[model samples]
Target: MQGKAGNAYLINELVRLVYLTYHVQDAGYGDTDVVVYARAEAALERCLQRAEREQVWRLEPDDAPMFEAILRQAGRQPA
Candidate 1:
């Protein structure tokens, strides 16, 4: 039960990460305020780190390039 709950939490984090990435990308491209963009970027970075720490899933090959691009744009190294 505990393991299942942990898995569920990780899954939620993954979903959050996906949404954060999209928000960050949109904020970056749009005329959004810098503070808003920075906040979204920071959230995305935190999510990325959390997902990497879980080590339960890897980005698909098709997704890797875009993910890396986002990290680079955020001035972070792809982990």
Candidate 2:
């Protein structure tokens, strides 16, 4: 993976896991689950930070709308 491609991959994977993690939980998650989602959001944020620093490719046009779409699909908001 080179610059943009690498960054895009990281973002894509993080978003996928974030969405998956939320959906796999019970209909009503407890405090622990909140912690879990928080961690996932944090991880996504970290990757996004790297993407900015590394000049990663765009998440929209060129690739999937990993950030907004994934969160929306999971009824989550970026924190």
Candidate 3:
């Protein structure tokens, strides 16, 4: 995992999980399944943290906006 392919894979994984979280909330399961929602949120947080720690955005300027958008969705300030 180095270079554009790695960046793309990480971004895709983040996007997939974010959409899954959104789907859970949109389906009203977030209210009924606290544990599930919490787990999803936790996973997203961990992914976001990893992206930030790796400086993924900075590594690939072309992918920066996408990473920033994901960060914002996770209520994190993009670095």
Candidate 4:
């Protein structure tokens, strides 16, 4: 999984996978950017909430820069 995000292209692939599997439509990559934006934001928020509740960084720094990077790759900014 770490290797899967070593570069920009890989990150794009990861996002594409998420968008496709979860049916997250693309903005410029499709007809409507608004729909994709809403769905993708919802998906990302769910993931973040889950991570927080699960204490996903117990043994780590808790900064979660990795997840942040993933968000950046998906064309989303961190909160």
CA lDDT of each candidate? 0.46, 0.52, 0.49, 0.41
Candidate 4 residue lDDT tens string, 1-79: 2312233354345456455533433323323334444555454454445446763312123324444444444554221
Each prediction's RMSD over C-alphas, in Å, is: 11.0, 9.4, 11.2, 11.7
lDDT of 2 by residue, 8-77 (tens): 6666776676666465444443223455566557655655776688666433332334334444545542
Ranking the candidates on lDDT from highest down gives 2, 3, 1, 4
What shift in Å separates residue 72 of candidate 3 from its native position after superposition?
Answer: 25
What TM-score would every model get versus the actual structure?
0.33, 0.44, 0.34, 0.32
Candidate 4 clashes: the total is 0
Local error of candidate 3 at 31, Å?
8.3
lDDT tens digits, residues 1-79, model 3? 2343456566467657556555655665433334444554464455456677875521334444444444354452221
Q: How many backbone clashes does candidate 1 have?
A: 0
Better of 1 and 4 by lDDT: 1
Q: Candidate order by TM-score, highest to lowest?
A: 2, 3, 1, 4
Q: Give me the displacement of residue 15 in model 1, in angstroms.
A: 0.5
Candidate 1 residue 77 C-alpha distance from true site, Å: 10
Which regions of candidate 4 fall more than 4 Å away from where they truly are?
1-31, 56-79
lDDT of 1 by residue, 1-79 (tens): 1221334465466455545655665655433334543554454455456457874333333444444444444443122
